[model samples]
Target: MSDATRPDPDPSIAELEAQEQRLTLTRFTHDDAWTLGSLLVELARQRQAPVAIDIRRGGQQLFHAALPGSTPDNDAWIDRKRRVVERYGNSSYLVGARYRAKDTTFEASSRLDLDRYAAHGGSFPITVEGAGVIGTVTVSGLPQLEDHMMVVEALERFRDS
Candidate 1:
């Protein structure tokens, strides 16, 4: 079937929520952040994706990288997307999807300053066992969906390894 005829590849809210639940880490430390961040950098390098990645915990940025083609704007996007994850304690993609499913955009429904917050994809909460969301992993410089998927892929790899 043509791509247009295929079902949307994006996961449903339940699926994304399950991801958040299932991907919980036993513990996350500075070293863990380094590993995850390095993994993301490697993935992006392999893909030749021009993206900016950021990982933060306890309100402190642990790692950040801007790939060759990425621009400063990507940093802004990272911050905005991270804010969504921070405020909602869910992946930014999930938050945006929930709003879209409700027949409204997050920009219209959230009533928050658009400059500081974005409901677009690319940020995932770093949830640990026995702790809620400890931080966020975010990417920018790709389409929102791609950005979100990249983070999810890295998180899965990090968890599995």
Candidate 2:
């Protein structure tokens, strides 16, 4: 079939809704945020690291904590995490995947913008499998690798519990 004669691929309504659902990070509750924050603080202590952490539900702040000596610069990670996840509908890992796929512009620029992406930090989508995004956990105050690791650890703990 000629390219022009082929029908364009389009999703059914249910498929479209499912896709939208997966991408939607719904607002979290104050309680949920606080819980996640406490988990992060505890995780940081276990790692023996002084880090600043922020947890958000949708666009709202649910929890925030700065370890001793954490600076203002550390606090911005959460915002960056939110911005990246909000735009990409995926976690930092997914963003990294996109980078690997040669779609590096958004990921690269997002990492550079402190207001929306931490160079080494990660954004974890607080979502259930097939449910879409519900919130995010963003942690900073260490190398980007460490920051991402910490967030991953915290999410595992939260998810398992």
Best by TM-score: 1
TM-score to native of every candidate shown: 0.95, 0.68
For residues 47-83, what per-residue lDDT tens digits would candidate 1 score against the true structure?
A: 9999999999978999999999999999999999999
Per-residue lDDT of 1-161 in model 2, one digit per residue for the tens? 99999854432335433433443333346776787689889878877777888777666777888888688877766576566766666565445544545745454554455555632345666764545676777777776656766766665555556
Model 2: residues with Cα > 4 Å off, grouped in runs? 1-29, 100-115, 129-131
Per-residue lDDT of 72 in model 2: 84
For candidate 2, the clash count comes to 2
Candidate 1: worst 10 consecutive residues by lDDT?
7-16
| C-alpha-based local distance difference test score of model 2 | 0.63
* Residue range with the least summed lDDT across 10 consecutive positions in model 2: 11-20
Residue 24 C-alpha lDDT in model 1:
89
For residue 42, give model 2's deviation from the true position in Å. 0.9
**lDDT scores for all predictions?**
0.93, 0.63
Best by lDDT: 1
